[model samples]
Target: SVTGNRVAHTANIDRIAARGATFHRHFTPNQICSPSRATMATGLYPRHHGLWRNGVALDGRLPNLWQALSLAGYATKGVGKLHFQPLLAPVERDMPESLAYWERPGCEDWHGPYFGFDAVDLVMGEANEATRAGHYAAWLKRNHPEVVDLYEPDANPDSRAQDLNEVWKSAVPPELHYTS
Candidate 1:
């Protein structure tokens, strides 16, 4: 495909390709987001990991790359998006609505064996680019209040939880955008 790609000519991928062989195909066990993440993290097929759908996620019960490394005495830290749990569901009926893995208030306090990560700055809400409000949100709150409203516009402390808007674009500055 790079044969016809104008931008590809400017990319250093050419150097990499010259040093190696180029192939167009790749493999994955599943197409769903959390399941695919779990597969890579846990090194298990979707069925084996017991997270075959979007609303479910792997918990402490599973063995993952982080856990293996941590067990061997590595000091682990995860920043940015790490979807170790399901965003749509509660952890347990008795437990309070599950704490987010991303930049949740107390999330930074818990030094866990969480999905093998000793510490995490998690970002959930992969459903919509506009929906993420985790550590990144906290960062904005601390460093730049003006940009905070753009990402979590309805996250008014005065208001109770509002339903998130689905599949939409935010006109927030590109400098403030996660993709940028």
Candidate 2:
């Protein structure tokens, strides 16, 4: 369906056809985030990496790309989301429902020196409008008490609805726009 979509005909994607090869047949060993990312890290499929879902962490024994790169004398720096486990104490599995407004936990520990990255800018939570205002948990308490009181598992009245490109454009700072 994505191949048939008109948006795929746009200039940016069209350039892929003009000078690049597109893999029509590719597969991820796991459909979920952590498992998929682990597969990427180790160049092994999910069965071998053993990361199953959002919360399950990769065993530290498994060799990862960062470790290999570091061994090769590369200065690793990660700037965006990597979805790896946090370095702090294993995160508490449970928090108030209000806290559920935040991003899923785990992988906060996966950044920085632990992962052989010399520098990292990590956000352990959702990077949306509500999160930009402050902690989504605290924002819920002060601003949208009614939404919080509803306790509906997916009631995000304050979350900003944004298109993918718009969200991406807004994320880039003016200073960096010229780099494109």
Candidate 3:
């Protein structure tokens, strides 16, 4: 099964179309992770939310989906990549630090416990660094061994023998779950 962009290209597009819904225009507030994710969480366009670039922290005063869901008494759990933060802030830093970047510091740590989500499997600002740790690459190796060699930078036998942990595959499924 494909995930992210691959799924967008193959399954997600067709699946949306199959439901008699047209896949119309889409736009991201920012091309980078932190800003785009802030837009999604806060339900505000980038200009209004002010997370215009990568490493920018989300303005905490803005009400995000989690808070809204919590107010509505829905169990709003967050998982995977929620890239909200002040530009260049790390996970450990809290509100005071965030206020330096933002005029109002609301949700200082995007991945830390916030709103009312009962459970969250979150990764903070470091997307690229996490990917290099080999979770996805390892899952790809186990599930699609045939193409493993194709991804190698060189033909060395030792390099090709790298094994990734199977537990990493236990994360979310590659497909989006929709409820009618």
Candidate 4:
């Protein structure tokens, strides 16, 4: 997410923020992504929402923004890293976001209606080079199979950031990225 105060590098985000509103003083009950997002979606604290950590699922029974909007006749679609459920759960758990589920026989047709989303195009993590699963992975495999190997962090043999194990400049073009 682009910070409101740091808009210089994010011209597109700045333009969107200019038309609406941007918050500078934001408070979060949970510091982690899943719990914090669950808080925002459910309007409840992490304890109440039942997503205390990253590898847990947010209680689907809880009221959420998507459910509210859907009830009001708005079709809700989620794209990218919506970590409502564990991304590495067991295959038997049937977690749509998990790599285990993606390896299953009939998982190809599964696209949507999860976590109050009428449709979804999900990615597990920000770095598609490493966490290659979900809709983005499928799309990449089907459309850009040749480029798939280039997405690996170490694919760029000249990259200095490879040893850092945190960040790296991917050989894949920016337009091919999941976030793009």
Model 4 deviation from the true structure expressed as Cα RMSD, one decimal place: 3.3
Model 2: how far residue 141 lies from native, Å = 18
Task: Give the top-scoring candidate (TM-score).
Answer: 4
Which candidate order results from sorting by TM-score in descending order?
4, 1, 2, 3
lDDT of 3: 0.48
**What count of clashes does model 4 give?**
0
- Tens digits of per-residue lDDT, candidate 1, 1-180, equal 244563223235666677898777987798977789889988999889988877675765888888888899999987656665655554342111134334344653444445777876655454234244565555656677777566653543432333334323444565765544
RMSD of each: 7.9, 9.2, 10.2, 3.3
Better of 1 and 3 by lDDT: 1
State candidate 3's TM-score. Answer: 0.50
Evaluate residue 163 in candidate 1 and report its C-alpha lDDT on the 0 to 100 scale. 31
Report lDDT per candidate: 0.59, 0.50, 0.48, 0.78
Worst 10 residues of 1 by lDDT: 93-102
Better of 1 and 2 by lDDT: 1
Can you write out model 3's per-residue Cα lDDT over 70-169, one digit (the tens) per residue?
8898877765545565534544564322323233333323333453455554432231232221223234445654544443224333332233221111
lDDT (Cα, tens digit) per residue for candidate 4, span 1-107: 25634212454676788799988798889889999999889989999999999999887889898888988999999988888888779988888877788887757
Which pairs clash in the backbone of model 1? 67-116, 102-122, 103-135
Superposition error at 163 for model 2 (Å): 8.3
Better of 3 and 4 by TM-score: 4
Q: Which scores higher on TM-score, 1 or 4?
A: 4
